[model samples]
Target: MIAWPPKAAPRIQPIGAERSAECAAIHAASFLHPWQEADFEQLFVGPGTVADGAIEEKEERLAGFIISRIAADEAEILTLAVAPNWRRRGVATQLLAPHLAALAVNRASSIFLEVEAENAAALALYANFGFEKVGERKSYYRAAGAEPKPALVMRRVLL
Candidate 1:
């Protein structure tokens, strides 16, 4: 029998205001435009929204996280990020598993998300998971003070 390497244990836990700072910092570092900590705080507290967070652990540090929400038979991937030190190690797959399963169970026939056209890695990841382009929202995001960037809308059918 081939001996498999030990896997790092990850925990999917509900996020609170306490970790908003770390989450925001990681979110900012991982994306061209990041949401403020206040935004996350509101998400966690906002009514009619369901969000879950995961922390990939090694010793005691947070390796990465993924956040999402389900609404009326549909779920949007609000954010999916892995810490720079922990990329390409299956952290994202683990984090997304629960949310995706739950969304499917909630009658989410299709899920949609928007990504920047220049973010090849993210686009590839979504495409690899069977998401297809459904539309485009031009100039959807801006880099702080720069001109807006085009957003590519993608969707995946689950049911």
Candidate 2:
């Protein structure tokens, strides 16, 4: 059987202004509708926003990232991306473990995220982390030359 988690774990660190371009590059490679560098800048400056990324130690490249915001006792994930080359190799888990811990430390009692219903990989990842489907938004995501896709709202209680 194949090893579930890779042996060489990714190096994770807090994402800052200096890493915005790298983050944008990884996001563009991962998603069809990618966030611009300016959008990442806005997120970096936003109140209560928290971001972290996984890096390839040898290549010094970003492999994945997670961004979220906390308000009161609740937190919501804005985006999560993993470079195509790094998918299914535990990069997302490395990014999420630290991000969730940070949110819990910040007194967040619950965390929420929206995932496209058809994204099996993301649904599995979130479910593995104890997230449960709480609601759904019909036609929440639109792609060029394709019909809108529904989004599943997932929640995890931290407290």
Q: Per-residue lDDT for 143 in model 1?
A: 72
Q: Model 2, range 86-116, lDDT digits (tens) per residue?
A: 7778788888988999999999999999999
Give the TM-score (vs. native) of candidate 2: 0.93
Give candidate 1 misplaced runs (Cα > 4 Å).
1-9, 13-16, 144-147
The number of the candidate with the highest TM-score is 2
What local lDDT score does residue 146 receive in model 2, on the 0 to 100 scale?
Answer: 92
Q: All candidates' lDDT scores? A: 0.73, 0.89
* RMSD of each predicted structure: 4.0, 2.1
TM-score of each: 0.81, 0.93
Model 1 global lDDT (CA atoms, 0 to 1): 0.73
> What lDDT tens digits, residue by residue, belong to model 1 across residues 1-159?
222464565677656667777789889889876889998888777653444556656564555666666777777877878777666666666666676676787677778888898888788778878889999989888777788999999888888
